[model samples]
Target: MTVARKRAILTADSVPMLPAHVRLIFNEKRDSWVVLAPEKILWPDDISVLILQNCDGARSIGEIARALSKEFSAPFSEILGDILEFLQDWSDRLLIRLAEQSGGKP
Candidate 1:
């Protein structure tokens, strides 16, 4: 059976949280930074700082997920729903994109 894939749509109005508000605590021993937001965002553990960094309203979810899969050795096929779920949580928290302003239904 073939699974359906959702193509991520990019918009101009999607604004990521600013760097100042998002703080990173690097664990040199671990070689990864622990990103802390003033409040919780969705699935923070599943996403990395780089993934959030590139979500600058230009890259689509598919693009980011693909890159993340390559960089982090994650399965791209399984990450789509997870990405969408993250986007939904971020939307609820007003973190990632202004969904209504973006003009497309997810």
Candidate 2:
């Protein structure tokens, strides 16, 4: 018998981090940042790089969105929506994981 693990859902309260098997590195040869995971390599755009860099397992989704919103002077709701979608896509690929939440409300 085989068991499958359930996928985690991303919420405003969820903290995101790169999984142990995954890494984000600057590829000197390519002159850009790349996400290295096993045999997979992904070249994310500049904006995506900013978002991924903030996935330090410390900030919740909401916090990240707020920071980016302030930095870019964009609306919070818009930034939040973009972040949620971006993180969800990466999470589904097993590149990102939700860290254990510290005591706090979303």
Candidate 3:
């Protein structure tokens, strides 16, 4: 993570959501959902699509990662860092936001 990214305040309770200009849409042609923004479209792979879907303003990063791990039969630690890095990258691009909340650290 960059210095600026490290400066971001992310925690277990911080809810993440698509930006106002970004929307999640199903692409029937591709049989997947995509992140649609004003100037760009993100076609994430199967796992990534699920990750993005879980970014709704309800589940925390920690909660999402935990649930995804069990659902996918993967280890929590294996996906935790990647999930955080993915969210932080989108947050940096203004495509997503980690809403402020007080709780456990991710």
Q: Return the top candidate by TM-score.
A: 2
lDDT of each: 0.55, 0.89, 0.76
lDDT of 2 by residue, 45-86 (tens): 999999999999889999999999999999999999999999
* Candidate 3 structure quality by residue, lDDT tens digits, 1-106: 6565444655555678776688889989988888889889888888877888888777888899899889989998777777888887787787777655223221
Angstrom error of the Cα, residue 22, model 1: value is 7.6
Pairs with steric clashes in candidate 2? none
Error of 1 at 80 (Å): 1.8
**Higher-scoring candidate on TM-score, 1 or 3:** 3
TM-score for candidate 3, residues paired by index: 0.79
Cα lDDT for residue 64, candidate 2? 98
Choose the strongest candidate by lDDT: 2
Candidate ranking under lDDT, highest first, comes to 2, 3, 1
lDDT for model 2: 0.89
- C-alpha lDDT (0 to 100) for residue 41 of candidate 2: 91
- TM-score of model 2 vs. true structure: 0.91
lDDT of candidate 2 at residue 92, scale 0 to 100: 89
